[model samples]
Structure formats: structure tokens, C-alpha cells
Target: MLRRARIGLALGGGAARGWAHIGVLQTLTEAGLAPDIVAGTSIGAVAGGCYVAGKLPELEEFALSLTKRRVFGFLDFNFNGSGLITGKRLCGELDDHLRPVQIENLERKFVAVATEYGTGHEIWLSKGRLVSAMHASYALPGIFSPVNINGRWLMDGALVNPIPVSVCRALGAQVVIAVNLNRDIFGRGTIVPDHEATDEGPQGLEDLARARSSR
Candidate 1:
């Protein structure tokens, strides 16, 4: 009898970096376990493409150089009046989750919060500030705010907290948090954490290979 099987794999950290996509493809080629279908989120799409098409020798170097140049150019602008915070929460199969509580303790300012799920629930918050106060809050860790990237508000991290509801709705995920804010790119972007899952990475590769072989 023939059986149908499936597996899930997750890769994070520097390994998920843009240039590293080529490396992942090369490794898969060497192992003879090339993926039949490749799908990814955010920058992972770039890597997934390289894996299927085979690596170009200078691709990784070029990608890295471009990223650095873009970042540096944005930094030169010296705009410091924006701030953001991101949080993620895990709501395990809950229904009608409340959206984040938005508190307005001061005029023309607000605080937003929400939950996210990957391996678990995550929460994010973003705080926006007036232009004059921007510089004083630079490099404030654990917060997501607009970073000047290539002369644009990249919306890198700080936007995460305000958009969880939209992300959940779009992705059809259960609403583990309340608040019906318009989900934007904030909580919808890439997240990189250092915890390793039990069946990810090489073990995942091996399992895929085994399943393919059995089929």
C-alpha cells in the first residue's frame, strides 16, 4: 500500500539571511534532496528562488554589499523623530481574541499592542514620537520603529504591534488578541529568533528525504 505523508521545516537567524539562500540551495543539491516546491515569507523567497535555480558565484557577495550600502545611505539622512515597538503573542487555538489595548495618555500620541503566532504566541508594541524626540531614542533595543533605509521609512520593526489583527485576518489565523486595528506590514514581516525547534534543520532535511524516497 502507498501512503501520503507531509513535514514542516523552519529555519531562522543568520541562516535566513538573503545571501544564505544560495548556500541552502547548494547544500540541498549536494544532498540530492532538492525541493519540488519552494515557498517562503519575506526575504526567504529570495533564498528559495536561488535554491531552485542553482547559485550564481557572485550572488551572495552582491546581495550583502547592496544591503550594506542601502543601510548606510539611509543612516546618513540623520532623521531621528520616529520610534516603534513590536511584540508577539501565542494564542493556541483561541476564538474571538481581543485586539491590543490602545492607550492615549498624552495628546497626539498612542501606544498599540497585539499578539502573533509562529511556534507560539508573541506580542508586539510600537510607539511613535514627534520629530524632535526621534534622535534621543535611537538604538533603543526591543522596539520596532522606522529606520531610515534608502531615504524611506522602512517600517522595519516598530510597526509590528499595531498590525497583528490584520495579519491574523489575512492569514486566516485565530484571533488570539483583541483590537481590530487595520493590520499592516508591522506584524506581517520577518521575525528572527534564536531558539531551535526539535525537528528543524538537518533533521527536517533527513525526514523530507526519507519521505521522498518512500514515495
Candidate 2:
């Protein structure tokens, strides 16, 4: 008399619109569908990490409070011209909520994806430093600073595997459920890959979120 296993739960990134994860997770909870392997990119990484770490409630609260002002508070908004998202303020906020909960100590098995810009390799994070991995996964190239953990510069995981079904499948998760919050945000003659010249501004991102939410 043993229960079955659910393979994967994929979360998508959508900046401020990541709040939709709250709703989706709520439904999943009601349905009693707990995924064994979880994966996500960008803000989606935040959702997946917090969920696997048993801190979804706090993450939901944090996502709900992401007003324009509050979101800006977690940026590298310095007049001295600093790195993009060089601020640890965002991670600090996550720590404040998910304190006492480490990534490896979670109850569920989790996976996070990060892309190596130098080698074009996809770094799948199923183990090792949790907080650092979360920070690297969410650090949107030009929007946030790159994470140099032990000399490895890592940015957003979505740069490569936005929908990490393959990663989850690789980790032995045969059944995958992917929740994409960043559908249609880019890759259509918009938001060029070059960070500095791209046009995924706050307004544009918010608009994308709203549009997705409506649909």
C-alpha cells in the first residue's frame, strides 16, 4: 500500500506576473497533486525553489507584495553605475522569509536550471548550494547582476531552458507538469537577446504579465 509518484512540476518566469504561480499552486494543492521533481526559470525558479523548500506560503506572500516600488527596492539602482541587479536585497528578502530552510533540507526533490553564458551549457541544479542557485536562476542578465559563484558567472536559467521538461525527465521524472508564466514575452522580433539593447522594460513586462493573466 504505497502511493504513486508524480514526476515533475515546471514553473515559468514572468517578472512581476510570477504571482500567478500562487493561484496555480493553490489549485494543485486542492487537487492533492504533489510533484516529486520541480523545475523553473527566472522568477519561476523562485516559485519552484520556495515550493520544494516547504516555504510556498511565504513565497506567495512575497509575490503578492511585489508592487512597483517594492520590486524596485530589490534592484541595483545606484547612481554610481553598478552592475545590473548587483543588489542582494532580493535574496535578502527571500532569506528573511525562507530562513531556517535550506535547499538540500527540503522534503521534496527539486531541480533548478542555469545557463553558462561562456560555454552555452545548461547547469542543472538538483543539489549543492540552494540559496546561491536560486539567486543565479533569477538574476536576469541585464536586469540583475550575474552570479560569480566560485568563478562561474551564472545568470537566469530561462536564457536556455525556460521550460525545463527535459531536465526533469533527465532526473527520472517521467510525468511532467509545466506551468509557463512567460508565454509570448519574447522571441518574436522583440526583446532581443542583447541585454543592454533589449526592450523588456518594467512596463513591457507588466503588460505581458497582465496579458497572460487575462488569458
Candidate 3:
């Protein structure tokens, strides 16, 4: 009997900075690596959803063709003043891309994380409408609109756990490979040129996310 390779993929969140995921995923596939399980947060869900839907190549194309505007659309203010992001466009995109695609129908197990804003609890949904789970995963507070799932309000998973490689491990993946796209390799914060004309790097988004969770 041929032994099967148990592989798991963990994806990270990064607002509009998920283009790297497309490249990384393509590289892994080209190298003959197949994941038996997938885990993701925020933009990672978009990429993960495509993979689960068996549309990796299409996802690559989508990432390459992905514009800053389209990615930023998730952060734009909607007709509803409370949420900075309007769910219509984001949900529409999910519907258009992952049509007729079910998570349970995927070649591999899929998991996406979401956080309940009320209690700041992590809700990992392994079974449900793939796109709906993804929508909740990418719901970045103050950026993307909150998603209502089963009467629970959820925001981006990154706010709670940006990396959930352990989730895949717990699910029985023999080998785990996680991709983190939110990392600023150089640790260089954003610089602002004020009247002083000097570089002033403000806090990173992750820090802001932490602040929000505390409140």
C-alpha cells in the first residue's frame, strides 16, 4: 500500500497585503507539495477558499490581477456609518469566485478562524458555507464590516490569533507549513514626514489590533 503524505497549510491575514500568498501557494504546488488540510485568517481566507474550491490557478490569476483598490474596498465606509467596510462588495466577490464550492467537498480539510466581538472569543468553523466562513474570517474591525453568523458578530481572526498552525496540527496534519504575510520583515514602521521633515514611524497595525481587543 502506498503511504499517503499528510500535509497542512496555515495562512495568515494582511488586509490588502495578501498578494504574496498567491505566489507562495503557487510555489508550493509547483514543488509537488499537497496539503491535506488548510487554515487561514483574513485575506488568507480568500486564497484558502480558492484552494479549497480547487481553483488554485484561478486564485493565482486573481491575486496577480488583484488591485489595491479592490483590496481596499473592504476598508471603505459603507452606507451604514458604523462599519468602515460594506459587506456587499466583499460578499459579492466571494459569491462570484467560490460559486457552488463547498468546504466539505474540498479535496482537503479546510478551517478558517473568526472572533466574536462581544466576548473576544475565537470561533473556528470547520463546517459551513465556505464563503460565509471566509467572509467572517476577513471581517477586520474598523476596516472590514462585521459578519453575522448564527446571531454572532465576528471580525477578523487575526485580531485574536493571526497564526493558527496549531489548529491544523490538532486536526491531525502530520506536517504543518504556515505562511505569514503580515510580517514586516525589516520591522520598519511607517514613516511620516511632518513639518520637521523627519521620519516618524507610528505603531504597526497589529499593535492597533491589540489595542482594540483590550477594549
Tens digit per residue, CA lDDT, model 2, 26-93: 79889998888887777777888887777789887776777899776666564443355575887778
Writing each residue's lDDT as its tens digit, candidate 3 over 1-215 gives 98886888988888767768888888888998988888887788778878778776876776577578867754446766546666667677667777566666677888787777777777675665787788888887876678776556777888776866766787888898888876622111121110010112322434545665698
What lDDT does candidate 3 reach at residue 93?
64
Q: lDDT (CA) for every model shown?
A: 0.28, 0.67, 0.70
TM-score of each: 0.29, 0.77, 0.77
Model 3: which ten-residue window has the lowest total lDDT? 189-198
RMSD of 2: 11.6
lDDT of 2 at 21: 81
The model with the greatest lDDT is: 3
Ranking of all candidate structures by their lDDT, best first: 3, 2, 1
Output the lDDT of residue 40, model 1: 26
